[model samples]
Target: MSYLQKGNSMIRRTTAAKGLALAAVLSLGLTACASSDDGSGDSTEGGGGSSEPLKIGTILPVTGTLAFLGPPEIAGVGLAIDDINAAGGVLGNDVTVEWGDSGDSTDLSVASSTATDLIGKGVSVAIGAASSAVSLGVVDQFAEASVMQISPANTAADLSGYGEFFARTAPPDTVQGPAHADLIMGDGHCKVGFLVQNEAYGNGLRDYIQEALEAGGCEAVYGGNGEGHEFAPGETNFGAQVTDLLAQKPDAISIVAFEETTAIVNELVSQGWDFNGTTYFVDGNLSNYGEDFDPGTLEGVQGTLPGAQADEAFRDQLTTWYSENESGELEDFSYSAESYDATVLAALAAVKGEATDGATISQNIRAVSGAEGGTEVKTFEEGVKALEAGDEIHYVGKSGIGPLNESNDPTSAFIGIYKYGADNTYTFERQIEGKIEE
Candidate 1:
């Protein structure tokens, strides 16, 4: 297939952008306005005969409920940027980057403003806003602006076909949902009560878990979407929800939530529920709860998240780098590798297409992603060598996401099971493997 000619491509992209913009204006009736706190004011860089360098904007949640996730995600981005620049950046100019925060879906104002600001600054590619629903809220804006968007920790299946410009390293929750149910059932918890946040991530995972639990002969006792038990966003005070779940008297409870996990657990304890029974958790609230819970508060609890255990050596390296760049230490490494891989993939795509424009980058992403007929290269510098030698290169990163599926999602990933200790911190249990059958 022949690539679009530069002139013709410009016309098509402009027309597409205009149409998408019009559609956006007509459909977006959201009243809440977002404000971006961390973002760059750099000039746009792309195929418009501009000499400005390639610019990327990181929009992961740098604050709010998911703040525990910020460290490793930012570490992944920072490390990739350093590696790419050291290898002689895309199209001869060092890539420039801007940082922004996406609080959560509850507050669309933050991510919405961040996306608008990043698009205005001419960012060729945008990464993040970890929440699946949060990403959904503003993805069209990036798509219309012609900015390639990559998310590192979004797993909602609803976003599977969000747009041609959207890509995510995280596998949809369907892959891990069964693992969660199987683990709970296998542990002999025949009856289960589920407490979910009632959003994309929570509800989607809940559907799969319910099916698996029933299939395994376990009963889904309570808590489902619109069941009057589903927690509303920012609806704090889980007192009522806990009281309701206890009424079901299930042997086990499965919780998929964000920061609310801590509050929910506190409620459970206050109401005479013990963690001694099997209590399963999902990615959102799997962080260290030591500050809030007493020793042994979560001692036998289990949780699961997508992604294999990061290699020990790599974890040490990332920790050192993270501490130097941002703050204390790398505590939760949930999507760290995926974040690194997403950034690197975007950068390599920019190089392969020889343009920083969103459309151009998206067009060439496969060439650097172990596509058919491409020579494999493991590092950015190595891929650069292959490019210099006039060879198409397939670049693989630390995440091991090989190539993307037709949906622009990772072809392979792992679901890691974790067990909590006396200190309310989790330790790796086992990894469930996944791959697209086709």
Candidate 2:
């Protein structure tokens, strides 16, 4: 696809003055409103037109099965916009954002209508729809409109080449699958059982895990891809499935679903299954279940979540941002770092291409992501300075993900290993790095 040229010179002058004012305010180091609107509705006008602002739409899960992830992910986007505007905004204009709800795949209406509204708003780029299946449902709309869709938490393998306008900050299941399998086997499990959701995300990830498990001399005793044991989306009752899976008598059981994990865990408990040390969770279902389970119920359980374990400072920042902008305290920091990186990359692509249109951003996204060799920089401020100095840059953000590969998936990513404590909350234990074979 051809890139659109820059817009009117008058727009440049107006934005330049506005950018100067914003920079001046930043020099005072005071918190200020960054986006054009409050972050919900059409924040700013222009749908990738020559004289429009760089509008960003977010289709995050604010009210769905994955709502647990919405806080951190949304905070990540907000914080990135805050930082970008502080650094004089993108292309001399404050980046505007609109937030939409990406309800879980069980209900397609939420994400479908959200995508439609965002497209109608003329967003140049959209940040989420964290679920891979949800993204699959709405991605074609974004692509057809020349609007880039960047998912920070999608890991389904099939999404690698779904569209030219699509890219993800998170690595695909190919990287996460082996990493998780290695973690499980490294714990000395010879036989594993999976309680997988019957969806692309779970099924695709299950296949990779099965492959890796076999390669490691371990066995997936139950719920392998296409197995009848897999549960459908929105499945609530797990009595039969849990009993059948436990009938395999596997040493370890991995839950590869979303919010349904709660019911599954309860079923396992009801069956008197000894899961404390053998139960595992994937990103889709890994969460803080402090209120759901009794104290010590999940003790010693382990899980794997994608993205590097964010440092304390970054975590604190996300907490602060969420508190100031939204309602509650941020607890789960699952894909926050990846979400931040996705937003930063889009803004940097806008800077590199000197235009906010999706086509231009898409063309330059890979280059800014370091697919083309360049000076490595961290943070948007540093990258902007480097670009202003006529030097190419590769942005290294908090996610620690490698450059976008030819398929637009991260070439390498970090998988954080978390262990549950007595309170049913998981803590970061360590991280393993994996390179995508693609």
Candidate 3:
């Protein structure tokens, strides 16, 4: 079966099991106003009161294409919020969050509408639209409304140039792309094959990889969009594409795709391809393949990403929290850590703003995360202290510390190299600097 057919089957199965009411809720048009209550917990209030509580809006793919990644991202946000509240809330006001699902749509008009509704209800900061395409769709709306949007996992190259009001924790695809290409071409490889998804995320990686490969004196044997069908993030069945790629007999194959790449990996293994000699290079989106693909099939595969695995200190804290909470097992992915950092940064910005308004919050973000100050921020408390002292703070997060350029994108990110082991686990090989020139 083709990828499109596989995607359709999965959606049908899920919808049938969830029933019509849930599906209706999922597909319902964006509501203009979300019901709100005043301090008395009754329906009477003009503003939720500047002194009452802090409201933050979150947008993530909770139900559709990128659903697998949403839970961890949301968990990270929740963790940051809990930690802040436990520490006596920001600026002495209780913090609250309202969440909306983005459903992985390329055109995020519905999600943008949801954000506007959150703004109407008085949220000062918004975090999410996990997919880059979705983030790109709603950036203008956030800018128009003066809402500070801090995305946890938007890596598209175009987003940093969106506006001053937007910020992303994840490094752009351009940074990750060249790193993967270097890993493949630097291994004395001559020719490589490419299988890319037809989207901004896929094309961005493809462009960077091609440039890096050519620079490294490697040639591309087969380069184009992956065939079989257009599959959303979680779709399966890439057997035909893999079979065609195997026919080319390249030294390596670069998969600039997502979960669909896992299916191709499976097909390659099933066909008894020479795994010892041929390499499979995947982008950061395939970081979670261990959870989705057969363990034995992924042995010897390689992947590149912008950040390292959750540091030991942070993982210990998260493990303790999960033991006391009902959020379930946390997967080890870069986005989870980035999500926590983004939320913390935004909250710090809000506290720095003092008034809890988006414009003030946006200005504070640039002040704290930018390079006007010394480039080091160790903890949330230290950031708060710096902001309180009227000193420009450079927020160093779990991802890394860097300056946001004119585009609002971080100028650099730590690049991590990972290899898949026989047990279907990803082992961190090493870290490199992702430095790109304008």
Candidate 4:
């Protein structure tokens, strides 16, 4: 069945001066030498005609608060590269990747420097910046350099139509937020409180969920956008925030911070607050806390994560690949499937356009995603074969997301609901499918 739903009823942050100067110089240089063809994806256009080797780059988190997401995401990229090369690579030349770090928003230097390095490397496609704030910090650099930036785990709603050069495999908060609100309301909670991180990801998601909650006749008693319960990034202390939220006498509370979730959880326990089934988590904090929290501490807690639940076959592939290549065990598999799809989609776009440059890839990305209707192929090899036979291919990747819409967000996606077990690890409960409103 097609994943699409009919009718779709559904940031530049400041950086150092050095990065800005470099990006400005690069943008001017590229514009000066740009081809007359307007990157319209026509075969006769100026940029989509090259057959050079596709060089991919990454700006994923290898350090900082969101570091837990790094393993699965990096593994996903490596696995895609392996598959692409094994299938004889793109345009008969082996694909290459330059790995870099996009540390969380706590330190802007990491993302800025890394983005500069990737853009300078002349990579055709850059694959990350997991945190929404981090991505916002460096998107202009990639956009200015005419490099396509595909993020596997950025979900801020404001990023929609940010530019022609930016795209993401993950559905925006527009899908996840309302879905999360439904989860809270479905369980009969009427008064909800949010202890959100005051950043792009947290603020945007808080707004959407709050809107849904109010629409459902539920009251957002505390932490409704700009109501002062929001915490800053790297905030290790949440005692006051918790105190403030509980004072609102809320029936449910959603914790929407990154690494700060641990501190918040601990504070909740200290306050003698009975969370269990009444507490909630979003994608940024839906982690396995078996080692962090005591047994049964989070037994009845539930959380929401974007993307469909991956099948066992794909899980095994990620597991096997990580074991053979990386050092530690793969723990949180939150965005692994999306990460794989991001890399594969970009590579497929390169193949479909018969070029490895960013402009060409951007033009063909939506087309290869089956936006115009085409044959469905699951694997990279199958997609290549189908494209070779003069067929427009729809890549049915493991993420189970529908084609990219006009905003470059997935037309439809699944938000997996998870419940914490006695071991403090979350297990899949069920998934809610949501269509992004076009």
Candidate 5:
């Protein structure tokens, strides 16, 4: 099947599953209500340790091929807000989020405009533009406005290097790709093939994985020919590409695409190609596999992603908070844990900066991450303690230890591997440590 077919198939499948909810939300603009706070009509007015409410904006794909990733990611953000508010809010003020959708276009222009609008509404800090392409487009706008933009899921390497104003909770492709490659190659695989989307995230992951494989003494059977450059989502057929890939007879194959992963898996299964011994690799996007593809096809497929929320001690507390305060269900998705952490970090930064403005918040982002002389911190209490002691702190987050290098990418941690089990379950495999090149 061609890339176009794979995308088409994905659209059809997602539409069938979510058409009603999408239509309902669109018609009523209830998508905007996803961030609605449960409060009476009374206004709580104050600022900077006053009783006023602090506003934050979130720009995520509420309606797009990547929609499944949005709710969970937002849930993380919301859970953070709930916890902070219950404990007297940020700096004694309530924090509320203004939510917007990036839509299916995922265009940077749209994202920039959205960010501009949010800044106009006086959001001190913003989280999201979940898609890297969309975030890249709007990053400059946020910088110009002096509004801090922290992405929960923007893992493109370029975003971190863009400026200090931009940061992300997720590790970039530099770490993620090598982690996947190590797992694929460490299994004694020699020949490898890659399928990548023709975007920054996809291309970067493919390049890093290829480099890692080569370093491990494995040859990439198919490289530089765009043999696997598929752009767009909801593609249904990948027969032609699969046939080409099978011809290479690689010992393993890594797919660096989002949203359309299940289609590729299903197509491979349909063609009678068993993945039993052949390693199949996926990135953070694999969290959506169960929801996007038939469970039967996904069984036994191996996926490499950031540490799972269930596997983290801090996430247990988060899960409890979410269950008690939110009406939505929570799951372990790519940016869910990180998104929550980003909000908490931003709020803590605001408190440390002694101001809730965007510029101060952005400047203090690295501080919250425990850069400089900052003490190693994680929870709100740790940060407060460090501040009280007048010490620089490093935040080892629930996501991982976030020691961003000069490039603004994380300098430590490993990608976790998991395998799909029966009944749409996932089991932990192992951690693949990644080396940073350059």
Candidate 6:
């Protein structure tokens, strides 16, 4: 019931550099005031923390190709902290966050520096690095320092055992991949081609779904092995790749590129591909395409994004919270719920384990997340109260992430199928329940 298995197991559905002079000033300033990452999670030794507050550092894509994701993620973590503090804080001390930018895969150095800076600031838990590759760039730094690294949207399947310190609220592509394949097959697309990026995010996901397609008696025309084409990071010109894939004559095309998706879609349209009919987009390309393309350019496109469709009330609340607190617009909610859940889970782990350092939180996370449940609690307030009463608790996240498996990936999650309309924006068409196999 905890881990989803298939074939007797289950399946589940699943930033910037500055000028040199300014850089020197910033480097020295940061080093001069940074705290030690001695597994203490205490900042009284240096910076970004106080004697009592629990410090959570964020290394999300605040700037870069994935910058569109930053607003909601930041808002999500912010709201969780607000709610926790309102409920009397973690361990009777407020939770403070240090923000850092995680540039996309094209620039891992940005994320790496920010992560090291945060760890040096003595954070017990850090949330972020949205892209799977982005997370990979900095996860080891945190793990080595005994800092918990919880991600909102690093969904690559191979990242399952990255480290004891690494865990993700986002379900892996192993779940979402099969869901996408099933949807395509269900829609009667027997021949498919893939146009994905070269990085782990695209290639890894493409591999998972290709297995499902073959298993379902479908043919992967251009996505398997030597035939599959991979675009290097920042290589926006998908013209040649599109032409070669068109020659493969797939009935359906699944694109798994990121910001470069805008250009790829444009080229696809130029090549006379009726995107409205046989095009599939993955989370990386499943945004309100109207923002980049002309209206109706992405109409009829279908895609899969991990996590449940946040109900209207939750969406509105997050929007309002972002407007009032974060001084930004909630352009997208793709990973908002997951972000909130990850942040809240860290705080709850701190409470349940009676400690706020990285190793302590890591040891308690699975226990607090229903590994061996003592009580079922949802909100941080409820969880804290239950712990106060000497009750062990299981936290069912607001995002609905199920109990984590041995690999620290969620055992159960929701994969939302999305369909675009005339406006290039998409709406949730249905929810696919995904389970992870042992």
Model 4 C-alpha lDDT per residue in residues 1-438, reported as the tens digit of each score: 012111211001122344445555654554321123333455512344556677788888888999999888987887788788888889898877767788899997788776776666567788897999999998887887778899999999878888888999899999998999999999999899888888999999999999999899998888998677788899998888888889989999988889999999999999887877799999998989887988888988899999989888888888877776664688778899998998899889888888878888888888778787899999999999998898888998889999998888889899999999889999999998899997
Candidate 2, position 268, lDDT? 94
All candidates' lDDT scores? 0.75, 0.82, 0.65, 0.83, 0.64, 0.79
Error of 5 at 218 (Å): 1.6
Better of 4 and 5 by TM-score: 4
**Candidate 2: which stretches are off by over 4 Å?**
1-49
Error of 1 at 433 (Å): 0.9
What number of clashing residue pairs does each candidate have, in the order they appear? 2, 1, 1, 1, 28, 13
Winner by TM-score between candidate 4 and candidate 2: 4
TM-score comparison, 1 vs 2, better candidate: 2
- After TM-score superposition, what is the CA distance of residue 172 in candidate 4 from its true location, in Å? 0.8
lDDT by residue (tens digit), candidate 6, 161-204: 77879999999999988999998998899899988788889898
Model 1, residue pairs in steric clash: 34-109, 38-99
State, as a TM-score between 0 and 1, how close model 6 is to the true structure: 0.90
> lDDT per residue, candidate 3, 1-438, as tens digits?
111121111101122223223424533543322223221211111122234356777777666556767766766776677767666667876567766666565445556555655556556677887777777777777666666788877877877577767888777877877887778866767688877776667666777777778888877777643433334455577677667777877888777665566566667778877554356555435555555655556677777877656787777666555444433676655567777888787777766666455655666666567656754666677776776676677887777736666566777787778887767777888888776455
Residue ranges of candidate 4 with Cα displaced over 4 Å? 1-49
Residues 300-391 of candidate 2 have per-residue lDDT tens digits of: 89988889999999999999877766747998898999999999999998888776877767777888898887989999999999888887
Off by over 4 Å in 1: 1-51
Best-to-worst order by lDDT is: 4, 2, 6, 1, 3, 5
**TM-score of each model, in listed order:** 0.86, 0.89, 0.81, 0.90, 0.80, 0.90
lDDT of 1 by residue, 248-282 (tens): 89899998899888788889889988786489988
Query: 189 in model 1: Cα distance from truth in Å?
Result: 1.9
Q: What overall lDDT, based on C-alpha atoms, would model 3 receive against the true structure?
A: 0.65
| CA displacement after TM-score superposition, residue 355 of candidate 5 (Å) | 1.3
TM-score of 2: 0.89
